[model samples]
Target: MVVQRLQAAALLLGPLIFALSPFFWVDGHYGITGGTLIALSMVPWVYGLIGEYERLRERVPTLAGLWLLLLVIGMFGSIAFGLQGFFEGVFDITERVSLAALDEYPPHSLFLLWLPGPSFPLALLAFGVLLGWTRMAPRWVAVLVCLAAVAFPLARVLRTDWVAYIADLLMVLAFGLLAWRAWHRPVAAATSD
Candidate 1:
């Protein structure tokens, strides 16, 4: 019961925090405050993702497991990215200099940034589809989740605040609905899976 509540809280809060982060961005850069929020958001986001896996695992064990794995990998990459922003803000490092330094380490760059980065959105896309397929959520919820998944990567890559905001809003709505359902569900039903 406690775990369910925690997961629900995480689901609601994680994306909310992340959505608010852009408000802290200054001069086209995530300052220390924004970076910190991004990093912190990942903690609850991870918990929420785990809870999502738990819900889906009984219906589709293999796909759920893969989604969880991908999400975790992508989370590590996100954390690294957030920390880089924090450090850059603290040290007054330019984006060009930071990218140049990171380029010097090909393996680190590939594993930490490039490879795992896409996994987050990809996993979300799969999760959204699975939610609809398994009848775990409404069709509109699934659609919103998929939209958010696609928007997330594009928002970051394009550095578009409006798109990011939209993605964040979609995430909040979709996850918020899931959390509400989880919270209101009978204990037996929640545990049965």
Candidate 2:
């Protein structure tokens, strides 16, 4: 019961945190606010993993576990990036930083931070696929999640925000609905009576 509530909270909170990112800070590299929120959002994502375990059990335990592990790796990456931003901000390093150095090095250039950017979506897409396979969610939902994840990179490459924005919105809605269903799902009576 406690976990369910936390899961619901996390579902609601994660997107809210992302929404706050833009207003709180501008530069992704030098700003800690966004990355920190991304890191903190992991709590609910774990709740999501827990829900998967309860739903799939041994049938797809491996997939559920994999999702959890990868998502966690992504979370840790977000934390590392956030910490890097914090250090940069504290030391006032952004100004002294060179464009050439930034182009070459960049913030979160390390595997941890970079990998998570994609890993997080991959994990979600995997989980969504599994859910679709189990008929837990509509296949369209899973498809949309996958499409959205895929669109992110394309959006970046194409230099368009619409794809990313639409994809993000879809994910937010899908997760929100899933969370709602999970949290509101009724428990069976102990006895049929």
Model 2, range 45-134, lDDT digits (tens) per residue? 566656656676657777767767887776666566556556666666772473335457655465645666567667766777787898
| Alpha-carbon shift of residue 192 in model 1 (angstroms) | 11
In terms of lDDT, the poorest run of 10 residues in model 2 is 21-30
Best by TM-score: 1
Clashing pairs in 2: none
* Tens-place lDDT digits, model 1, residues 25-140: 75656668878887789899779778778879989999888888888888887777777778889999987898899899999899988888787778888889998999888888
Badly placed stretches (over 4 Å) of model 2 are 27-30, 95-111, 151-165, 188-193
Residue 56 displacement (Å), model 2: 2.7
TM-score of each: 0.92, 0.73
